[model samples]
Target chain A: MKHTISVLVENHSGVLSRITGLFSRRGFNIESLAVGPTQDPEVSRITIIADGDEHTVEQIEKQLNKLIEVIKVRTLTKDECFARELMLVKVSCPAEKRSEIMTIAEMTEAKIVDVTLTTVTLEICARYQKLERFIEIVAPYGITELVRTGTIAIQKGSETMDRKK
Target chain B: MKMKACQAMVECLKAENIKVVFGYPGAAICPFYDALMDSGIKHVLVRHEANAGHEASGMARMTGKPAVCVVTSGPGAVNLITAIATAYADSIPIVCITGQVNTDQIGSDVFQEADITGAAEPFVKHSYLVKDPNDIPRVFKEAFYIAGSGRPGPVLIDMPMDVQKAEIDFEYPKKADIRSYKPTLKGNAFQVKRVMAELEKAKKPLICIGGGVFAANAQDEVVKLSHTMNIPVITTMMGISVFSDDDPLFFGMLGSHGVPAANRAVNECDVLFLVGARVGDRAVRTPLALEQTTKILHIDIDPAELGKNIRVDFPLVGDAKNVLTQLLERAKPMQHDEWLAQLESWRVERKFATAKKGTVVPRQFIDKLSRRLPDNTVVVADVGQNQIWTATSFHIGEGGRFMTSGGMGTMGYSLPAAIGAKIADPKRPVIAICGDGSLQMCMMELATAVQNDVRVKLVVMTNKRLGMVRELQTKGYNGRETAVFLDGSPDFIKLAEAYGIRSCRVTDDRSADEAISLLAEYDGIALVEVIVDENEATL
Candidate 1:
């Protein structure tokens, strides 16, 4: 099963490397990982999408909690949390196909970020499923380049994951 | 007032109440060594960096405090990796300080430089690389805190040469505030009640003690619980000395090398309460047997250990001492006379035979040594056949301690570890029991012992071969022994004499008793080499 785990860790050098090293050493397959500064500047939130069974996921959570820098860990349930991914894709589009690409982007609510003579770049930010659909629709035009920011997640309601001390 | 970072490092150690250090120095760590000279901390210069780690680990195991080891960059630090891993496996607290190349040379592949922190990441509880001198005090404080805290393990601090040279105002923190690292000390009230309920209903309850019981200093609590409830207690190799062998409720060790009686009891138990034990492969050799017969209630400090290797029925995540204390409070005094009698019958049925008269038996030697040593003696056993012999035969009396590389099974741990244990408390008698193969791995430490006047009795069980591996081949591979025999092993007595240490060699049954007397009477470092039959089976 694929699970999204939210890990809040102290903002310190080498912590990311330590975490990634753990995943690799344990042979846990990491599907996607996105890290960014949290609401507290001194802390960072890492969202990791990993594939594992029940036991493996439990081990991952326990191991993360063991790390000194890590503050909190939560495996976000699908209903209780909202997740989003951002992608910037450049697709090959000639002048004749530019209008058609723009129509598709409009349908997906993706914004045009840049346009060149032979390529059109679109930026899309949505739930994972929506982003996947948008990419699939754009694939017909021939994707020249693609970059994803992975996924960032938060609880659906007002429950905040904060450090106790 | 400002001082060099290296000086501040020494001062920080003093503030942490560290009295001794085991280490090997090199060019990268010269600055720290220079500062150590005036720091007033007793430094035992180890023969090898790996020995330094083992020595520190021994001290930590004996004293229940974080031991310190210092090494230089590259190979110096690399050599300590195995020791660090061993400490991690056994949950022994050790602080390993390694000197690095200058800050500018860090990532440039300069001379004698290596990524010590990177190499140690998997094993260490926590690690730090100091880039600034001002962070020295904080880093040391955090290192000590992390290493000695709950589920204790090794922690490393890699200090760059430039950082050690730079001057800074040293201010050691009174406490480390690691918000994410709070270890649960008390067991949950509801969980304690649940365990009590289980105890009340259990007909044939067994308590399986692991190394965590010793780590939590809950030996007394566990003993009391076992005696009050009339429960049979079996130990993993790591938990060997947690309960005395003579205790009526205490059964022998459990697992692959375990006594047949203990394994049979575990296979028959209705409810097995595992306190501070991980129930690893060695301890639970036949998991299916346990799963089919017993309902396991695992009490451990680390949540990760619960249901890790086996499915735990009742999980209590708390310090062993606290959880055991709570269980004792809520537990009702009960007796299982029938169950106890059945266990006793099993024990009597599978008792080992007495040693034959002609040859020097390893089990007989251990039994003789156990009787000769004082009640408080600390026995450090190296890995291999010697370990199994000592584990099965050595009777640890009250106040006695046994230290070994149970988890990692590292060879060459006993001698230096004995030195460390003796150094920790000079009043207690310490012994290092090693096989010929194991002793040769770190025999140079005899020089360190002589130089420091550390009185650790060293016993070498000489079989002229790697007995354990040879036994494995004999049993599993149709007796085709290869690369197991030591064709030309050195004369250990001469080697000890060359190091200026007193030594003796024992052959035949009569000389073995004489060797024991010599070990008992010796005041400083001494070695006793006992010749044993090479084909003696361990299991």
Candidate 2:
């Protein structure tokens, strides 16, 4: 099952390695991860999407809690969280098909970040599936550059993600 | 004052007053090596990283402090897994710091790029990966707090190359913020009153003390409570020195090698007041005897530990010292001179007579050694027969200590742990006594003594076999020995000699006396190898 892990860590060096290390050691595979600064200057929030055993995820959350630099950690399952990913894609399109691709981009509300003769780049931010479907629509345009910020998320309510009874 | 990152790290270590560290350094940890060159901190370089972790765990077990170790990343950190788990299982406080790839190159899969925090997560109480030099001190502070507080266990910190090389203004944070961490300080007063009420109403009241008494630094508190309450105190392996064995109210150790009267008393007692020690398999052999005959009042630091192995009629959570001191304030100090006299009679009926084999028994040798030891002498014992000898026969007078890895019962804890404990309080004499099997497990640590010039006496009873297992077989098995005997034991004297430590081999009573005399006169680490019959069981 897929679960989302939110980590609050001290803003410092090697913090990323620490977080990633936690995933591997606890036997949880990180399918996606997004790290960025939070309102608290000293702290950063890392949102990671992992797939593995329920017990393994529970353990990963605990391992994350052990790091001194990590202030707090919570794991939110797919059913209990609002999650999204951001992607920027550059694609090759014939002059005749440019308008047709633009229509599809409009339908997905993807922004045009860059454009050149025979190439059109669209920036899309949405749920992972939405990004994938948008990519599939644009796949016909001959792919070029594909960059993405892995899944970032927050739980639906005032939940502290401790499932142990 | 500007200092190197490594130097600041060492200063932070010194601030914790951690005098001993167990590790095998490499190119990756060269910065730490440079800082260690002229520092006062004693570093015990083990043959392997796992041994370092094991040694650190041993030290923590002995000192009730968070022991430290350094290992380079990748294989070095990975090598420490089993020992880390040992600390976790036993809740020994240890801080493991490993080298890491530079911050920028960490996920780039640069040279020696291994996820140390990830690898150590499951086996540790906590872990950190420091990418910024600025956070090093902060992480160090938090690591110690987490590892040594709440429930003690191992904590790992992976310092990347840049962080280890980078420097910033440094000052040890005088305090730590652990809003998430709040350990139980005192038990509920009402509950303690209830226990007192029960005690007031009970006829046969018994006390079982665990390692918590020592861990909580409540030795005197426990002794006071036992004597004042007039309850017979039976200690588990970890609870060995909470009260002296010869005290008026002291019942010898309980469990497998327990006095028959103590075990029988466990059956007769109407109320069992267990402080700090859990009712483990060795302490409570069968459910029929322990199930319903006695009302149990369980008190421990960790809430999860209450009723974990056995059911509890009353449970309290907090530091043992606080719990005990508070219990004294509210408890009625019942005078049970009649009950005490009955116990004294039982003691006489089941007194363990020192086997009068012309050959010196291990217990007698340890007793002689203890007598010659100084007032502040610290003795570390290996598990198996040696622990039985130390717990039952050896005496710890005021100002002395008896330390062992009892809860974990890990073999080979003596030598390296002795180095760490001796370093912790150098003025106090430290000696390690081990069985042949356990000494072999961590004997490489004798070199650890030589490397740092730490003086801790190392004594091994060489039976040329796994004597404990063989003894168990004799008691429980049908006389068939399986993988018990060592074809030919290595010369431990020569092994200690390789480490530049003074050593000797003693076989008979005269030689044993000479060995004890030499132990008192020696100025540095000494290895005394005593030859003993494999057939003799510890009890």
Candidate 3:
């Protein structure tokens, strides 16, 4: 089962190491993790996608909450979250295949960020499954390089994980 | 007027009311040592860095305050890893400060540079790597606050050499308000009432105590609740000394090495209210027995501990003292004379096995010592057979303390930890009970005891082997003993004398009384080495 966990932590050096160290130590398989500055400068939000059963995911949530730097932790079900992953892929493209590659990029609503004589770099920000399908379509053209920003997520509604006084 | 970062650190220690520091000095920590010279904080220079960590833990356990340990980076910091983890496992609040290489040279593989914070991340409650001098006061304050609060544990602050040298206007924070680190101190009224409602109807109720009871200073409340509700009380190994053994409702430790009566009570109880215990594997050797017999209501300060180990029917997240107090208020007096009588019968009928002649039995020796020691004495037991023996047999009186490496199960913890306990409270007698193999691990701390004039009695159970492991090997491998014998171990009495402490050796049960008296009557540091049969097992 796939679960998305959102962790709010104090913006301190080595805090990330502490959280990731816990995941590895507890043998939790993390599929992807994205951390970025939040509205509060002193706090950072980490979105982690992990593969585990319900018990394992609950253990991870409880363990993550035990960290002193961690302020709050929430396991966002698919229904209550807006999740996305951004990927930049540089695919091998010849002059003749450029139009076909461009059409595929357009169909997926991806942007052509850079282009060279033999390569076309495209950036796509979409849901996890959509990005996976897009990558599958481009793989035939030969993807020379790719980088993913992991997954970032937010609660869809007014439910806020703000630090309660 | 600028001050050195080390000076600021010393001043912050003073502000935190840290009068004693257990530490060792080295190149990276030179500046801090220099500043400590005139800082008025007494420094007990331990022989090994690991001893410093245990001593600090011992002091913290005794005083209910965060103890401090300072060491240099690299091997010095590495040496304290075991001790730090020991404190973390038992939730002993200790503030560990390590000096690092200069900030610019940190990643350059400079001399004496190691990522101490990274190494200690998993075990420590929190860690800091201070890059700026201005963060010194805040870091120290936060370190102490975090260590001493919310299921207390060890915290580390890695001070870079340059940061400790930088000058800044220092102002220690009056209070630590870490916005996100608030711990729930009071139990929710709804939950408290719910527990009370259940307790009112419970027939065979039992209260299982753990280290958190002592950590929260709720021993009195635990005793009061047990008496008021006439509920039986059993403790985890770390929860020793929380309840007096003489109490009618008190059962001994409940776990793998626990008495049959305590384990039986755990299996027979109807409502098991666990206060401040995590129900670890050692404590719940047969979880199936507990699950089948009782519905567990776990009250703990840390939410992470609620459902981490076992199934909890009800959880009241609050400080043990506060929650226990609330339970006492709403709870009505009850009588379970039938249940109490059943437990008492089991306690009387199940007697531990006695030792054969020619062997100085560990349990018999501990029983005698328990009878002879003062009511306020503190017993620090090292790991292995001696620890289990003491836990099962030794009786702690009111106001007495019993400490051990319950979580990490670190050997060589007794001598240094006893020294720390004695230093924290000189008015009380402190004893360190260790096995021969365990004693050899950190016997160097005998020098620290002598140098500081720390009057702690060192009792080495000289079994000539790692008795516990040897017993396991004997049982599991069909009596094949491997690597369990200590053939070249030094005589502990001679070792104590080498450190300028009085010493004696006892070989029989007849002489055990005299040895106990000598240890009790002596006014300064002393050691009593008891030679026991190597074949005798802990159980």
Candidate 4:
């Protein structure tokens, strides 16, 4: 099962490797990880969704805490968090089929970022599943290139990651 | 309380950040293994002393730290020579601790007595023979530092049986001050400038790389040089993935078994600028014959490499990366159209790979296996054809790494070292590449991998013969295969199964595909055995 986790860490070299390393070393599949700077320049937040049993997650949290760079880590389950994923996918499109591709993009509320001689780039933002589904349906159009910003999570209630237990 | 040499060794190990060691217990080395009890420095007993030494090399490669291998003196120490030489060649930081003959019997040639210090000197960076127990602490500290620092290579500490038998008011020295041993970190300014001036004047320049590029963490600098100069870069097998192929200037690896473009470029280029590498037989198989009038500038930290093969016009005996940075200041911006064009013309779909003539091509299997793993996975390749294939076909990502016995070319390296790498970062995927012959030399370490819960996927290119020798016979000799194999080989999957590790076998492309799928999906230590025909060329 995929469990979202918010990990706060010191901005240090090799810290990201250490975080991902814990899951990999433990033989857990880390679904996705999105790391970015918070308001504090010294601290960065790593939002990770990893597949593991509760004990494995508990171990992961403990391992993260053990790293000198890690400040804190907390499980941000789907029920307690609101999340979105962003992706930019370039699909092969014939000149005549451009309008048909644009129409599909419009219905999904995704914008067409670029149109080249042979490809059309679509900008998407939604739940991970929604984006995946959109891409799956459009894959027959031929995915030439893809870039996804993994997934980022924030608590649904007024509580921020730092404010939550 | 009188501390045994074993206890003293443990104390030194803890101070050196050594989390684990691989070894076997003998009459002399048994006490040290016993001392490991209650000691946090985990001691893994291998099936043989040679494997212990090889494992230490793997550990060092995996963790970027010095690794220890302990064994009894005499035959045991002799066993470690091949392993030590491999570390020496690859420049992996390994500190070997061997049980020696009692101090009283120095030259008596008693049973299990050998001049281990004298034996190891030619191969090791530094060899220390300790007679007194008091020197243990200082020697241990120095051994660790020397093994890991500067050019990273193996160092030996042979403790007398009496010394391990004696006690020490052990005082672990934190610093080492050796007058003769200070490594040159900064390049000579004048030489650097001279190089820079030449680089500018030459329209066609190519950078021939060695293992030293990665050793100095000069990947960025190398990338900078190639980008700024628009110079094509070719590497020794050891220098393989230090830079990415996506980098346009990457001419691919050079030497006898190198990419045709790289070799052809070496022949075609007017200026061959060697950086931080030894122009070995592998790098410059046809050093004598040049397609064009080539001028070579050998830049290496070790002075011996300057005139060793091809006489160096500019023999700057300094660190390759350090000197290259200095040369960057003076290197010109001239480009050669004809040279670049001719070099490009030499390319024939430019793949650095070969196949087994008699049976399955190992490169195809290894490349397929490598593709299944994540781009950032680490492959610890043993010496021989396995290392060659790994260097050629395993496309490393930004963090994907390849570690092997480059200098000594030690066979039994994969399994144990992967354990250390796995320990270094348990979450990152670590795989070991070995041949069937090499795998037998260190197969006992499967126990170590399982015991530590350090799972490193073991991928063996099992050809059931000494593939390197086989290659040599074909390439160098008249296809005369010698003492290369025994009739029956042990069932590796069953062997791994015995150790409670999952395993898969790949005989054909179909089994290869299925095997790759399973190996990638499995979490713990999995053995993927690929059967290649006996007639394979390493290059």
Candidate 5:
């Protein structure tokens, strides 16, 4: 099972390592992670995607909360939050095959960020499942490179995992 | 007033009311030493940076306050890792200051440069790398506060050499108020009521304690709770000295090396109130099985520890003293005479046979030696079988302390820790009990003791081998022993003589009795080397 843990931490230099170090030390499996400054300039929000069962995920949240810099930790389920990951995929497309690849990109709502004589690069930002689908559709065209900014999430409704908690 | 960052660091210590520090100096940290010389605080120069750490740990464990240790960069700071990890494992409060190379040269790996804060991140409660000279006061304040606060542990502050020399307008903070670091002190009222309800319904109730009880200074509250409710108490290895083994309601330590009575009581207890104990594998070999049968209500300052090792039935996150006081206030007079009688029936006392003509039994010697010491004697036990012997055999009377590297089980802990314990309270009797192998590991510290004029008693049970590992080989490895023998070990009596410390070697019952009296009565630092049987066992 995959669990998304949203953590609010002090916006300090070493706070990220404190969270990563804890995950590594406790042997928790981190599938993906993304951190950015939050609404308050002094606080940062880290979205961690970890692979664990119900018990292990609970343990992970408890352990994360132990760090002195961590202000809040909430294990958001897929239903409770909206998640997004921006990915860039470069395909080896000759001039002749450009139209076919462009058609596929247009259907997937991926923007053509860069283009060259021999290759084409498209950028997409969507939920994890949509990103995977885009990659599958573009794989036939021969992907030369692919990179992803691991999942970042926010609450679906007015609820927020901020210092207010 | 404008002052160098290093001077401000010393001022911060003075503000915390620190009287002394243990450290070893090097090039990177010389500036701090220079500033310390005029600060009116005594500095004990430890032989090794590692010993400095252990010594500070000893002080912290004794005083219930965060103690300080300083060392230089690279190897100097690296050497203190063992002691820091040991303190982290046992939840001892210590503020470790290490000097880094020039701020610009830190990552270039210049001479004596090390990323100590990065290296110690996993072991420390929190760490700070002071880039700006003005951050010294705030960092020092936060370091001390974090090190001594809820679920206390070591904290590291790595100061760059250039930063230490930079001048800053000094203004020490009166209090630490980190936004994300507030600890829950009082127990939840509903949870406290829930625990009381469980206590009322439990037929076989048991209370298990750990080092957290001492950290919280809640020994009185725990004892009061036990007596008021007539509930039996058991302890983990770190929880020793909370109650003597002879106390009618006090059961022995639990886990792998624990007594049969305490382990059985844990098995039979319907409600096990675990306070401040981590329930490590050694303390509870099979937590799952016990959780299935027993209702475990765990109260610890660190919420992570509640269900880290076992499945907790009711988890209460708060300081041990405050939560225990809450339970005490809401308690009703109750007794479990039948439960106490059943636990008593399960108790089995071991009787050791007398020592042979020229070989003294280590356990028997410890038993005799402990009886002669004062009620408040501080006993520091090293790792391996010597720790087991002392933990199982030594009787800790009222106000006595039994300090050990329980969680980390590090070797060579006793000698330096005993010296630090003595430094904390000069009037109390402090003793370090170690095996021959463990003694050799820290034997260098005898020079520190003699140089500082710290009168600490040392007892070395010399079997010429690492007895614990040797015993394991004999039992589990087809009796093939390897690397367990101390083939080139120096005679401890002669070593003590070289250090100009009074010492004795006991070989038999008569000599053991005489040496015990001599070591106990000696006003100066002393060592007693007792030759034991090669195959002596630990229970």
Candidate 6:
């Protein structure tokens, strides 16, 4: 099972390394992780997606919370949270195939950020499955390069991870 | 007043009430040492950088406070890694300060430059690499606070040479308040009530303690709880000194190499009150299986330790002293007469096989020595077969201490540790028992002992083998023992004498008795080399 772990940490130098170091040290594998500043400048939020059983996930959550810089940790499953990932893809394209790729991008709500004579670069921000499907349809166009900000999530409804447990 | 960053650092140490520091000097650390010269804080020069750390650990364990160790950059700091890791593993609080190359020299591969904070990241509770001189006082305060606080462990501070030379306003923080680092000290009222309810219902309940009990200085509170509720108590290896061997309510140490009664109590107990123990694999090999039959109520300072090892039915996160004190307040007398009797019945005296002629049996020797020592004696046991023998045989009565590198199981630990403990309290007798293999690892510490005039007793159990590994090879590897021999070992008695310390060699139990008396009665440092049968069992 896949679980999303959201952690609030002090926005200090090496805090990111400390969180990532903990995951590797405890033998927990991270499938995807996204970290950025929160509403409070003093604090940063890190979202980690990992695959583990219920017990393993619980252990991971506890271990993450053990880091001195870590302020709070909450683990949620995909069904309970709204998760999204951002991807930028640069695909090989001639003038003939450009319109065809644009239609596929239009269907997925992806934006064409750059247009070159032989390559078209597009940016897409969507759920993990939607991004994967978009990649599947555009793969035959000879994709040249791809980059992604791995999965980040927030619980659905009025629940905020910012509140103290 | 404005002063060098190094002066501010020394001032910080004085503010922490640190009267002594164990360290080895180098060019990078010279500025701090120079500032320390007039600060009235004593510095003991150790032979190796690592022993400085170990010695500080000894002081910390004895005083129940964070002790300090300092070393130079590069090799000096790198050498102290084992000691740092050792202290971290055992939850012994120590602040390790290392000098670094100039700020600009870092990452340039300049001479004597090491990223100590990066290297010690995983082992330390927290660490700092000071780039600005102004952060000196604050960093030192935070380092000490983090090191000595809840679930105590080692913390590191790496100061660059240029930064130490820069001037900074001297103002040490009166109190360290890290917003993210506040530890839970008191247990929840509802959880305490639940624990009480469980205790009321448990027929074959047992209390298991660990190193965290010592970390919290909660030995007395735990003892009170055990007595108040009439529960039998067992301890993990690190929890050795919490209960005396003669305590009627006390069972022996529990683990793979644990006392039969203690192991059986763990199996039979309906509710196991795990106080300050993580229940490592060595303590309970099959935690899941044990969890099926036993309802474990674990109270620890670190919440991460709650369900990390075994399943906990009642998890209480707080300091051991506070939680146990909470339990003591409303606790009433309860009966486990039948259960106690069952445990007592299973507690059989272990019989030792006869030793070869002209050789001493370790267990018998330890028992005799323990009896002869003073009540306040501190026994520092090094790793390997010697540790097992001492842990099983040493009688730590009231006021006595049992110190070891239990969690990390580091060899060559006892000598420096004994020196540290003796230095911490000169009146308390300190003895270090180590095997020849382990002794050779840090025998250079003899110079440290003699130079400092720290009169610590050394007991070398010379079995001419890495006895623990040899035993493992015998049992598990079809008796194929390779690279287990200590063929080129030196004469430890002569070695001690060369260092200008009194020394003796004992081959049998009779000679061991006289040597023990000499060790205990000697006004100065002494070394007793006890020759043991190579095939003697660890148990």
Summed backbone clashes in each candidate are 0, 5, 0, 9, 0, 0
For residues B109-165, what per-residue lDDT tens digits would candidate 2 score against the true structure?
A: 667678777666667777777767887778899889888876688998888777778
What DockQ, on C-alphas, does every prediction get? Answer: 0.84, 0.11, 0.73, 0.01, 0.85, 0.74
lDDT of 5 by residue, B1-539 (tens): 79988899899999999998999999988889999998999899898889999999999999999999999999999999999999999999999999899888878978877778888888998889899999999889999999999889999999888999999999999899888888899999999899889989999999999999999999999999999999999999999998865689998899899989899999999999999999999999999899999999999999888788999988898999999999999877897999999999988777888876678888889988999888889999999899999998898888888999999998999999999999999999999999999988898899999999999999999888899999999999999999999979997888999999999999987888888898778889999998988888877
TM-score of each: 0.95, 0.75, 0.96, 0.70, 0.98, 0.98
Q: What is the lDDT of residue B526 in candidate 2?
A: 90
Worst 10 residues of 3 chain B by lDDT: B348-357
How much of the true contact map at the interface does candidate 1 reproduce, as a fraction?
1.00
What lDDT is reached at residue B312 by model 1? Answer: 81
Which regions of candidate 1 are displaced past 4 Å? Answer: A94-99, A115-118, A163-165, B348-359
Whole-model lDDT per candidate: 0.90, 0.78, 0.90, 0.77, 0.91, 0.92
Candidate 3 wrongly placed segments (more than 4 Å): A92-100, A114-120, A163-165, B348-358
Please list the residue runs of candidate 4 whose C-alpha ends up more than 4 Å from where it truly belongs after superposition.
Answer: A1-165, B1-6, B290-292, B327-342, B350-360, B471-482, B534-539
As a whole number from 0 to 100, the lDDT of residue B52 in candidate 1 is 96
Q: What DockQ class does candidate 1 belong to? A: high
Q: Rank the candidates by DockQ, best first.
A: 5, 1, 6, 3, 2, 4
Candidate structures ordered by lDDT, highest first: 6, 5, 1, 3, 2, 4
Q: Worst ten-residue run, lDDT, model 6 chain B?
A: B347-356
Task: Choose the strongest candidate by DockQ.
Answer: 5
How does chain B score by TM in each prediction? 0.97, 0.90, 0.98, 0.89, 0.99, 0.99
TM-score order of candidates, top first = 5, 6, 3, 1, 2, 4
lDDT (tens digit, per residue) of candidate 6 on A1-165? 888899999998889988788888888889899999988999999999898898888888877766778888899777778999999999999999988998988888999999999999999999988999989988998889999999999888777887533
Kindly report which residue stretches of model 5 are placed more than 4 angstroms away from their true locations once superposed. Answer: A163-165
Interface RMSD of each: 0.6, 5.1, 1.2, 19.9, 1.0, 1.2
> Candidate 2: TM-score?
0.75
True contacts kept of 5: 0.91
